[model samples]
Target: MITKVTYLIATILSVKAFPQNIQLLSQLPSDPIEQPDSWAWGRHPKEGFGYKARNSLTLEQCIDNPETAGTVHCDGYDYSYPVELCISMPRLAPLKVCADAKFPKDFCVSNAANMVKAKGCQKFLTDMCIMDISLATSQPCADAEFPKDFCVANAVKLIKANGCQSYLTDLCTADVSLAVSSDCAGVKFPASACTSNANFAILDNCKGVEFPASFCTTSVQIALLDNCKDAKLPKEFCVNGDLRMIKAKGCSKFLGDICSQSLELANSADCLPAQKSVSVFRCTRSRDICLSQLCELKVRDKGSCPQ
Candidate 1:
């Protein structure tokens, strides 16, 4: 059973800047395959799509070849993951960075941006979609430390430069993969030019199986779970804390989800209902917070306060 814990909505609303035409997406046509289900198994329908079936090498093949990479299986299997999965974590670039008549043409921004506009012009919405993609592509991006837009932005650059192509069958795939395999994306340097500051290529999430259940490090997860009190947190989050609940940050905007934005809709509950809330960036997993806002104001329940 799902628990609905009450939360004290924040009194303040933090206004964010959304673009004037960000809502122009209703004018764009969506790709049907990009719908929810097909995207999960990482299906890529484009031509040069899909991985090779023989990506995994057996011990015998490796022993005979003496040049085999490893015994593990790779997505190089006969199907390509969705483009979204390839660059799973998404981050928004300025409308300027990805703004081209040719964007996502050959562009994913066309699809992602549409999803962005439909969310009523909010970063949180954009972030959530990207996060979901990141999870599909790699689990770590779901953590607070790994924002989704970041992945989207980076992946866009890689795809655009590659001219839409890849899979193990092609000796040369997309630019990002090409760069990694050939070590020429400038993501790294030649032996003479290599430095610690080089932009490191990271494996996507599920690929990072032993990655300590957080992005880049363990501390980030600990701090977030500590703060939010773990409303709907997954277990991968840490569980070390006082277990005391605190007023959730940005509760007003997020509060509506706990019940109804309309007082009448929420009050429809015959009795006091417990509202469950999960903070956006909590790291550690802990007990759910139980909250009640309408009453603590100390107003008399009898007469009713301002609607």
Candidate 2:
């Protein structure tokens, strides 16, 4: 038998243990992202709360164009516009729950609405991105060629299994949009998808990255790189040869020219690796040639620097 003191300590320890069970419906964002017990991307309004107030809008308009659909009037701030459905949701990060035993069908479905409230549709997109990569590599994500609807149905199972949700809304929305617009099946994400947590940035340039909707805002470095051409590289990258080569020659001029443009690369980290990618792509030893060819393509195509 355990003593009261020992039992109490054990109970306390369990709360902070790795993969601790979470109540899917009621979990809140309080832990830091780096902590083992912290739910990844579980921070509330990870982008920041700037809206004055929420206004009612049709689901269609919101889905069709969230930015222009309606305005959110706040107390102190000017009337701000509504964001995407994914971003507008109060909480979108998935609750980290324990999967010790097989869950009943009702527990899965019944809690789905609540789970949606907690996790949003972000995870779905991430899974789709992973699936696209798997397919591109000739490694099917699953054993069978299930229909799109079948895949959609299995999405619930994915959530139940604690799978990713970064692109959930995009996946389902794409399916819905297929009948009306382009085929969603053809969408392909770059290798470094969802690397940043800038919500506005993701919506603008990093859509393929599939960050939580809350991460739609720009970062300080990204914002700074916009107006400052003389912006220096973080001290660490300056010392490294390959990385420095990318910055000094390959993307140096390109970075100065386009990194400031909102539509082009703003993240300096992204720029460095992108510039370095020319190193492996070209068959030439001449750094200038490699930089001109690869960097030009990246700038012209609006594509990610090679991974």
Off by over 4 Å in 2: 1-153, 156-193, 196-232, 247-307
RMSD of each: 36.0, 30.8
Model 1 residue 82 lDDT score: 31
lDDT of 2 by residue, 1-307 (tens): 4696795566445445525542223434363223333223231333311111133343444445434322331121222232233233323212222112233333333334333223233233323323343331232233223334434554433321223244443343333332123333334434133332222232223333433212212233332322222444342333232332333332353343333232224344455444433333331333343334335544443333333
Give one digit per residue, the lDDT tens place, for model 1 in 94-133: 2221222122322233444443332222333434345344
lDDT of 2: 0.33
Q: What is the TM-score of each candidate against the true structure?
A: 0.14, 0.16
**Whole-model lDDT per candidate:** 0.28, 0.33
Candidate 1 Cα RMSD after full superposition onto the native fold (Å): 36.0
What C-alpha lDDT, on a 0 to 100 scale, does residue 257 get in candidate 2? 35
By summed lDDT, which 10 consecutive residues of candidate 1 come out lowest?
Answer: 7-16
lDDT, candidate 1, at 157: 34
